[model samples]
Target: MEPSSATVAAYSPCGSTAAVCRAVAEGTGLAWDERDLARGTRPEPVDPGTLVVLGAPVAGGAVPALGLERLGRVHTAFSPCVLVCAYGDRDPGHGLHDLEAIAPGLGLVPVAAVLAPVRHVMVPALGAGRPTADDLAAYRSFGAAVASALRDAGGLFDLAPPPLPPASCPRERLELGFTAECDPAACVGCGACAGACPAGCIPADEPYLTDTARCDGCMACIGVCPVRARSLSDPARLAAVRERCVAGWEGPHRPRLVMGA
Candidate 1:
C-alpha cells in the first residue's frame, strides 16, 4: 500500500525519547504514534513512503533488549528509517552500533542517527546536577535539527563517530535491583505502576507486582503512581533507578543512514 503520511513511533523507557520523537514529528508536520514498547506491542506494516522513526534510550551504553526485539520485528517492514538513541553525556557508541546491527536484519534502512543531551536526575558517580538552561536549549536545538533532517535528509546534523566498533553488538542489560521497600498499604491496587512500567515488567493484572527481570528500572510507574506506594530498597540502586527514570535524554548528533536495498 502507498504510504499515507509520515509516521513516527518510538519505544521510550522514560518519557524523554518519546518527547523528542514528538518534537520531530510536530516540527515536520508528520503523523506520530508512540508505543511504550515496555507496555505495548509493535506497529503493523506501513508503506514505503511513510517515514518511520524508532527511538530508544541508552542503558549502560546499549539499547534495551526489549526495545531491540520490538524494533527487530518491525524493521523488515519499514525501510529508510530514522534511528534515535537517547542518552546522558556519555558517548553513544554502543547505542549506535546496536541499532546499526539490527537495521538490516529488520529490512529497515538507517537514514540518519543523532545523539542529544538528556537531563539526568540520578547523580552519576561522576556527573550530577539538574540540566541548565543551556542544556534544555541544546535538546530543543537538536530537536529542531531532527525536524530539519526529516524535512530534507541532508539537513540532519552529523554526529561524531561512535566510540565502539560500528558493528559491535554489546549486551549491556538494564539491571533493576531493589532500591527501596514498597509500602503495600500505600499501594491502592490501582495498577498504575504496572501500567506505567516501560518494560512490561510489572503485571497490572492479578498478583500485580513488578517483575525485576524485565524492568529497565525507568521508574515511570513510581513517578506516575497516584498513591506513591512503590519505593526502592537500595539507596544506591534507587539513585541509579532515579537517574535512569528521570534523566531526560536526547538522541545522537545525527541520524543513522539506511542504505537502500
Candidate 2:
C-alpha cells in the first residue's frame, strides 16, 4: 500500500541530528513533518502506511530520557520507525541501546540505524566546528543510504536488539567547568550564556550560573560569548569534558533489532 503521511521528528539539543534528518527527508522526496521534542512537542499521528523517522543527539551516551518517554507514548501508533542517533567521533553503543530499550515498550519496530558524526564543541583544539565539507558529504551519503533502506525494506528490518553484553570499559563523566572564566568584575549582565546554552542549564541574570545536572557540557555558551569570559580551567578540563561526554558510548556503533517481542 502507498504509505501515509511521513513525520520527521527530532529531540536535538544542538540541532545537529535534526539537520541531518531534514536533509535526508528532502533528498528522498518525502513530505515529512517535524516535531521538536525538546520544546515539549509530541509526534503527530501517522496514518496507515505512514513512515515515522525519529532522530536525537546522543547526549551523555544515551538519548535523553525525555525523548524516550515521548516515544513510548506514541509507540503503539507508529510501527516500523527508523531511529537515528547522532554522535561525535565516539562510538554510539549505549546510546543506541538506550534507544532500543525505549522503543520496544512503545511498540515501534526498529528498521535501519546509523551512527552519524556531527561537529561537537567539547574540545575546540580537537577540530570541533561546523561539519566540514567532507563531513557533510559523508552525512549526506548516510542519509541517502537510510532513505534507500527504508524504501527497499518496506518495513522495519529484523536485527539483534541492543545493550549487547556490557563491556569492561570505564565510562567517563562530564566535568562541569567553565572554559572562559566568567569574571564577576568585568561581567556585563547580558545573560548571553543563558541564551546560548543548548541545554538551557544557564540561568538568565547577573552572576549567570549553570546547573551542572542539566548541562550537557556542549560549551556552546563559551563559543557564543563576545567577551571571551567563559572558559575551561585548562586543557585537562577539556579532556575530562570529552571523556565524560562519550562515557557510555561504545564508539561508532549501531543497534540490533529484536523482533517478535
For each candidate, the alpha-carbon lDDT, in order, equals 0.54, 0.55
Tens digit of lDDT per residue, candidate 1, span 91-203?
44477667768766766655555454454323343223313344445444544454455455442223222242353234565454543235776777877776666566666
Tens digit of lDDT per residue, candidate 2, span 117-186?
6665453332254345555565456545545655555445433332233422234423344433466655
Alpha-carbon shift of residue 195 in model 2 (angstroms): 3.6
Give the CA lDDT, 0 to 100, for residue 4 in model 2. 40
Please give the distance, in angstroms, between residue 1's alpha carbon in candidate 2 and its true position after superposition. Answer: 5.0
Q: Looking at model 2, report the run of 10 residues with the lowest lDDT sum.
A: 252-261
At residue 46, give the lDDT of candidate 2.
Answer: 49
